[model samples]
Target: MKIIVDAMGGDKAPEEVVKGALNASNNPEIEIILVGDEKKIRPYLKDSDKNIEIVNAQEVITYDEQPVNAIRKKKDSSIVKGLKMLKDKKAQAMVSAGSTGALMAGGLLILGRLEGIDRPAIATLCPTAKGPILMLDIGANSEVKPKNLVQFAVMGSIYSKEILNKYNPTVGLLNIGTEEEKGNSVVKTAYSELKQISSVNFKGNIEARNIFDGDFDVVVCDGFTGNIFLKTVEGFGMYIFHQLKNEIKKSPRYLAGAALLKPAIEKIRSSMDYSEYGGAMFLGIDGVLVKCHGSSDSKAIENGINVAYNSVISSINEKLREGLKSVTEKGE
Candidate 1:
């Protein structure tokens, strides 16, 4: 299997991203094609070999650039070039630590969506209380219709079962209240539809506080609300890290005890790290499109590579296609 990576998409540019591709290229069967400025990548990239090759590109889309505009104007941009590798069938999957909007737009406009899928949602893997839970629409469709929420539920359920091995994965809709009648029109309508699917483990609505409480295996929401939920967890986790540091500095005795628990604390932080899960793939797309964090490091990028490779090996797109087909046939 071959994967295309945008070498200059993240904050560290070609350096960390290139290092990641090299680190990930250890898998002999997986070939990696790095797309970016060859001049800059050559220095940072390790020994030139058969597995990892650089495809030179001229420009890069900044975090602030308009997604559609940048893709249209910057013909040789790293994002577009990397996507083209997938479009041309030169690569099985594409991974990029670039603007989320650009990747989503490019995946839909360039790589295209799978048959029977309306709007593609970004699926994020999170370490929940029970185990890893799949959350859909982390930052894809903000204004999701009731049908979109139902679609996310179906997709996440199948993905979790296929990838994470969660048989009969329990599905929950993210809402302010747990009661069936305690949400807005969207949640109310979505809850009704989700209940209609006998295959789905519809467990009722989920509150953000209960998200990490380990009640369900999958959480569903539109991109806007899901994005807010994702970032809020990230922010709170970081805040706790800083607070513990400050408390450790309060006294010598506390410092000694803190040092004892430092390893455990660090492990918790690492467990909460989003980088460990790799990029959020735009599910329901024709081909696999993995989106990494804007500030991802080499390790994070490797995780992204592994995710894309696994999706290809596991036939994630094919499973999603069949899943959507079953849902549509049910007329739910």
Candidate 2:
């Protein structure tokens, strides 16, 4: 499998991205294509690395630029070039730790949406107490119709089952309350539609507070709500760790206790780390696209490449097309 890495897309560009791509290239089955300024990306590569290739992309799309405009104008940007490679079937998938907007826009404009999907959704895996839960529309579409939510559910369910190895994954709609009567008009309508879909194992509404329990394998929500929920969880995790460190330093007794429980603490920390989950998958798109966090480090980028590799080997887009077609046929 061939995978493209946007070497200049993230904050740590070239260096970290190159390192991660090299690490993933160790797998003989995969070929790594690093897209960015060749001059900046070459220093990190070893002469012995034969599986890795570099494609020169002179421009970069910054977060400041409008997504669609940047994609159109910056033809030589790493984001655009990598996406174009995927569209041309030169690579099986592309991974980027760049501006989320540009990646989404590039995916839409270059690869286009799958036939039955209205709008592609971003499916992010969040660590939970029981295990990991998949949530969709984290930042793809802030506003969505009821039909859009139904599509999100369908895609999320297939991803959970195929990639995550979940058996008959149960999906839940993120809402303010657990009752079907709750939420705004869009959600209420979505709830009714989701229940009628026989393809997805649709559970009733799930509140954000109960998400970490891992009762549901997949959670569907509009981008506006899903983004807030993801960010809040990240902030709360940071706050807890920070407060714990401060408290441990203040008291000798606490310090001793913390030292004794260091192993357990590290385990908890690893579970919550975003790098462990790799990156979010842009589902419903015509091709495989994985978007890493803007500030992702080498380890995160490496894992993101693995995620893309898995998606490609699984032939996930083919499955998604078939799944959506089946749903549409039944509805019609």
Candidate 3:
């Protein structure tokens, strides 16, 4: 499988991105195409083998520029060029740790949306007490109709089942309350619609507090709510670790106890790490695209590439198309 990496997209461009690509290229069956300024990316590939290829892209779309405008004007940019390669079938997938706005815009403009999909959603794997739960529409579409939520649920289910290896994944709608009568008009309508869809194993509404229990395999929400939920979880995880460290330092007794429980603490820290899950998948896009964090390190980028590889090999897009078709046929 061939996967393209946006070499100049992230904060640690060219260096960390190149290192991640090289690491992922250790798999002989996978070819890594690094697209960026050749001069900057070449140095990291001194000991690289045949699986790695470099494509020169002179421009880079920055977070400051307008997303659509940057994509249109920066024809030679790594984001645009790498997306174009995917559109042209030169590669199976593309991974970028760049501006999220540019990646989403370029994805729609270049690769287009799946035939039956309206408004592609970003599916992110969130670590929970039980395991990883897939959440969708996180920072993708801030405003969405009821139908959009239904689509997110469908897409999230397919991804959970195929990529995450979940069997008959149960989906939940993120809401203020678990009751069917709860939430705003969009969610209420979505609840009614989601229940009617036979293709999805739609569970009732799930509150934010209950999300960590991992009772639901997939949770669908509008980007406005999902983004806040994702950020709050990340912030809280950091806060917990920070407070623990400060508390441990305050007392010698606590310090000794923390040292004894260091292994357990390290395991908890690993579970909370965003890099462990790689990156979010831009589901409903016509082609495979994985969007990594803007500040992603070599490890995060490497895992993101593995995500792209898995998506391509699993025929995720094809399964999604079929899933959507089934929903449409059922008049959902």
Which candidate leads in TM-score?
Answer: 2
* Model 3: residue 64 alpha-carbon error in angstroms: 2.3
Which portions of model 2 miss their true places by more than 4 Å? none
Tell me how far the alpha carbon of residue 113 in candidate 2 is from the true structure, in angstroms, after superposition. Answer: 0.4
Per-model lDDT:
0.89, 0.94, 0.93
lDDT of 2 by residue, 216-320 (tens): 999999999999999998999999999999999998999999999999999999899898899899998899999998888899999999999999889999999
Whole-model lDDT, candidate 3?
Answer: 0.93
In model 1, which runs have C-alpha deviations exceeding 4 angstroms?
A: 48-50
How would you encode candidate 1's per-residue C-alpha lDDT over 98-123 as one tens digit per residue?
A: 99988888888898988778899999
Candidate 3 collision pairs: none
Query: How high is the lDDT of residue 328 in model 3?
Result: 90
RMSD, candidate 3, Å: 1.0
Question: What TM-score against the true fold does each predicted structure earn?
Answer: 0.97, 0.98, 0.98
Enumerate clash totals for all models, in the order shown.
0, 0, 0
